[model samples]
Target: MSQDSLDDAYANATYIPGAAEYPPRWTKEARAFRDNLRENDQIIEDFPYGEGAREVFDLMMPETPAMGLAVFVHGGYWLRFDKSVWSHLAAGLLARGWAVAMPSYDLCPSVRIRDITRQITLAVTEAAAHVAGPILLAGHSAGGHLVARMACENVLPTNIANRLKHVMPISPLSDLRPLMQTAMNDDFNMDEAAAMAESPIFKKPLSVPVTVWVGEDERPAFLDQAMWLAEAWECGHVVEQGKHHFDVIDGLTDPDSLLTQMLIGGDIA
Candidate 1:
């Protein structure tokens, strides 16, 4: 595809079709997923946070001491979804001898995107305090964007940022400029200044390790976002596999997959 076509696809892939048509059903499925995951795991429900918003994180540990901590952030384009839906992800990391922490932040429109970012930062920082060893940050979609931001902040001497081992941004939205063209902007509220400020691609390279992952079948925009962030950071790897946006995350569940190996600090071919 041409460069322009690729750009258009990334900007529009996050746009949900018929979003106004199924609020009830959507809520039912989301809740079901959350409840199902919670039933199987020992999760720390409703971890407190700023204002009225709070985050819930599920911690999964291996039988022995953990090799490290993997803090995961869920993505609903920064609007929907929560940590509960992603608790199943902990099983894979747990088997690999790594502790996993999944945290949910307040969705957009209720809270601005900036505040949402801050809330996630607080959630990860708090979780890091209780877990042993350094952290490997990972997230899907908007969650990927948040992880990238946290990795960039590792340049600072803050306790949380300093403890970061690496970052894996799966199908991340690195550049917010194109998102302004979509209806998602309604909740994202990406003013030109905020877009530039929040975008990881526009920021300086992070000293920490970063690995970008996108499915081969994902929209061009999604792939570009991964590449853009990888280039901007000037210190990461990118993997394009034969999966789509959602299925790409499923690949991480497989211990032998490249996604899992990268998370565990193994060689990625």
Candidate 2:
């Protein structure tokens, strides 16, 4: 592929038809889901981790005694989507007796990716403070990359860090340097140095196990990133056949999914 083609390859919109529709639908569905949760007083809304407007998160408490927290970070290539669009995705985790915390963060153009990474560290840390048990960290897309970084680097303080039981980065862009050649870089403004610093593939092996799951039908770049990171970190990779970038995240919302089972400490095979 030419440089331009390689750059286009990184943009999911280029490969997934009707990609623009997902966000709006996600917004609508997630809003309704949150509203329903709030109506029954099943959720804790607007719990702030930072002063910024987007630094807040919604905590969906499990109906029974809680299992643990599944801290999920929303992804928009570090540009779009807030935590609002992802509230319902926590249903699977919630059903499995896990309290789910979905956090929002400042997006790009207003903040750098590094800043977003830090915000998630703060978000996860804040969520940990409230739920003082094992933390199952999971994120999708760019959010996936952030959680992976948290695994490699010591994002949380020692006390909280030890509570992080597992990390799941679904279809993560673990190698961020490639984005420098893509149009998304316009908003990201990720120079070579920053990309290298942020890419978890370049970081040290994580002490916590990271189970990476990807869609078989996703672009090769996405596939390569997951496989590369799993190999580099000596972790597990679960490739679901016939899934694309968009539907690949469906696992997060399904209790019986291999991906969700991985996060909740169940069987994947």
Candidate 3:
């Protein structure tokens, strides 16, 4: 396919109606949610995991003692967004009696994708120090790709890896070689070797369980990406009907949602 076609395939907002509206809505809801949690003394704002300004993460404590830790990484193609914009997403896991950690990492052009992966590793390690029991990871889009990376052998330390209960990568870019052809690659600065090395599809999955989740209404590229990871890792895959890239993550807001269940359930063994 031509470069233009590749861009079209990976382009999400172009096909999703009113895509521009989602961010602002998310920002508003997330802000309100965080404020309420803050008022109730249920959150720890700007918990630092690294010295970088963007390396801080917010740890949201549940109403009762946390059963375990669930870390969520947000997606903006690894070029946009921060942990603050996604504060609301912690609701589902927190409601499920788990502490949720939302982390912000240095974006591309400022740091490479590999660097961002390491930043998330630091965030997870730091968050784990505060919470106990099992560790569950879930990320959306680019964030999905990051979490999936955690499942790769040697990506995470043995101590953390041993406690991993599950990993759910939603609409992940498992094979990033195609992305190198996209216009966004300019910021990624990834050559063939870098893309291959970072791609979860090309890496071996650790013994921990994984689940590749995608939206049936997502662009074909994302659907293909999800399938590639599931097939490569030989893990569970779910394509939610009527859901698109933007709304596919909405399930994370509901404690009873299937996405939430699978993420914290750790039943995919």
Candidate 4:
């Protein structure tokens, strides 16, 4: 396909209704959530995971002892958003007694996607030191791609890898090859070699459990991307009915939501 078509295929906000409102709504909700947690002294803000300016994470603790740690990474095609806008997403797992860590990594054009992956590795390593038990990962869009990378062999330290219980990549870009065809590649600066090297679909995953989740209402390209990762890794796949790329992650806010249950592992009923 032509570059224009490829770019159109990957364009998410353009296809979603009222897409402009979602980010502002997310910011408002996230601020309220973080402020409330701060009031109770339950949230730790801007904890540095790495030396870079954006290499910080926010840890939100539960009322009771935490069962484990769940780290969430936000997505803007690896170029936008940060840990702050996703603070509220921790509500579900927090209610279920799991501590949640949201980390912000340097964006593309500023740093390569591989660089962001390494930053997340450091973030997870640092966050894991603070919380005990298993570690569950959930990331949206480009963030999905990063968490999926963590599931690959040698990407994370053995100690951290061993503690992983589940990885749920929500609407992830598992294969980076296609992104090269999109205009976003200008900022990504990914050649064929770099794209293949960074793609989760091309790498063999470690022995941890993985579930690829996507919205049924997402573009065909995203649907195929989700399926490719599931088939390549031979893992579970969930295409949430009626969800679009922008709203599929709403399930993370509800403790009883299937997405949360799958990630944190609890009684489904």
Candidate 5:
């Protein structure tokens, strides 16, 4: 495909005018909620998994005894965002008594995408150490790709992998090769080999089942991505109607949302 066509396919943010404004809102809400939690001593803030400035995590302890561990990884296309902006997204999981941990990894351009996979693997393992029982991974966009990568990267041991109940990658980029043609690739510096190495689509079959979700109104490529990964991994998928790329992930912050329910392994009935 021509470079223009390819870039258009990946231009998710462009589809949503004023998408730039979302981050500020996330920052404001996340900071306020985190402060409330801190005032009540309800959170473990800036807990480190690595030495880098971005390698820390924020743990939001559920009010009740935690049933399982749930890690929410943020999405900035492997380049932006930190755990702090996503603290508020823990509400749904927290309400279910699931201990929620959000980890920040070194961004691309600073570190290759492969390095991010390692950092996230370390973060998840570290978070899991502090909580007991099976763990569920729910990530958005790039975060979705990361959680999916964690599932098949040979990073988790059978013991830990066995305890994994679900792997959900919401609006994830399962195939990274196409990204090489997009402007996002400018910061990402993805060559053919690196894309092959990083795309979850090329990874071995997962250690656990994966559930994919994408906004029904998202770009065609995104919908294809969800279906492609599901087919590649032999998993299932849901096209969230009336949702776009950014808002599609709003479900993670709502405990009653289907996305949250999927992670908790419970049914609406």
Candidate 6:
């Protein structure tokens, strides 16, 4: 489909209602996950990004110099949640002797989406300097948007973009035009121009590897976004998880899961 036609279809698309309340049950599970992080894990909270802006990121390091680092960005549709909620994701990477970094960016409406993307760039660039080895990027939801943006060489410093061995955007929001038509945009404050600018599918593909994964049970829009990114980048792999949006991330914590094997570079069946 033409970009314009896609935009038009997205503009007219119906907005699917998300969970009405914060998934309290998931939040509780996340808390337990956080408590279980290795004792040696280090959290560098509220690191400065730009003037008057800070991002929180936690680091989980193994006993030896890591073979590679995995940086994870948390998802909340660019408007809600924080890094504390995703420390659980670090546990599995740490066990594999991969250092992990989870960064929290300022949410939208209060801060424009572009600025939020910039903040993530800053966080990752800074985190990269401190780690000992190559870096791999991963994120869930809005975080997937940010990390995908980093794959674009022009969007990030040349050094940082080139340093990425791979990028895994889980349950990503690859196209933002659909969001402009939804109530979610009320806080996102995105117009046509902003949507096009932030949409990864509209950007030129990076040479770096990008793997896009989405839950089989997710909304069609979500699944389409993943497919769009995979085709646009032409360097991404799409994995279908027999799970829903929220539960799909749980795969990150299970080393035996396909998601983990892909992230850590295990043989894919």
Judged by TM-score, which candidate is best?
4
Question: Which residue pairs show collisions in model 3?
Answer: none
Q: Write the per-residue lDDT of candidate 6 for residues 83-179, one digit (tens) a residue.
A: 7777666766776778888777788788889988888888888788878677888898888888898887688787777778889998888888877
How many clashes (backbone N, Cα, C below 3 Å) per candidate?
1, 0, 0, 0, 0, 0
| RMSD from true fold, candidate 2 | 1.5
Candidate 2 lDDT by residue in tens digits, 139-179: 88898899998887556677767877899898898988888
Best by lDDT: 4
lDDT for position 125 in model 5 = 89
Which pairs of residues collide in candidate 2? none
Local distance difference test scores for all models: 0.73, 0.86, 0.93, 0.95, 0.87, 0.76
Better of 4 and 6 by TM-score: 4
> Estimated TM-score per prediction?
0.83, 0.95, 0.98, 0.99, 0.96, 0.86
Clashing pairs in 6: none
Give me the overall lDDT of model 6.
0.76
lDDT of 4: 0.95
Q: Residues 115-185, candidate 3: write the lDDT tens digits.
A: 99999999999999999999999999999999999989998889999999999999998988998998999
Q: How well does candidate 1 match the true structure, expressed as C-alpha RMSD?
A: 4.5
Model 1 TM-score? 0.83
Candidate 6: deviation at residue 200, Å?
0.6
Clashing pairs in 4: none
lDDT of 4 by residue, 134-181 (tens): 999999999999999999999899999999999999999999999899
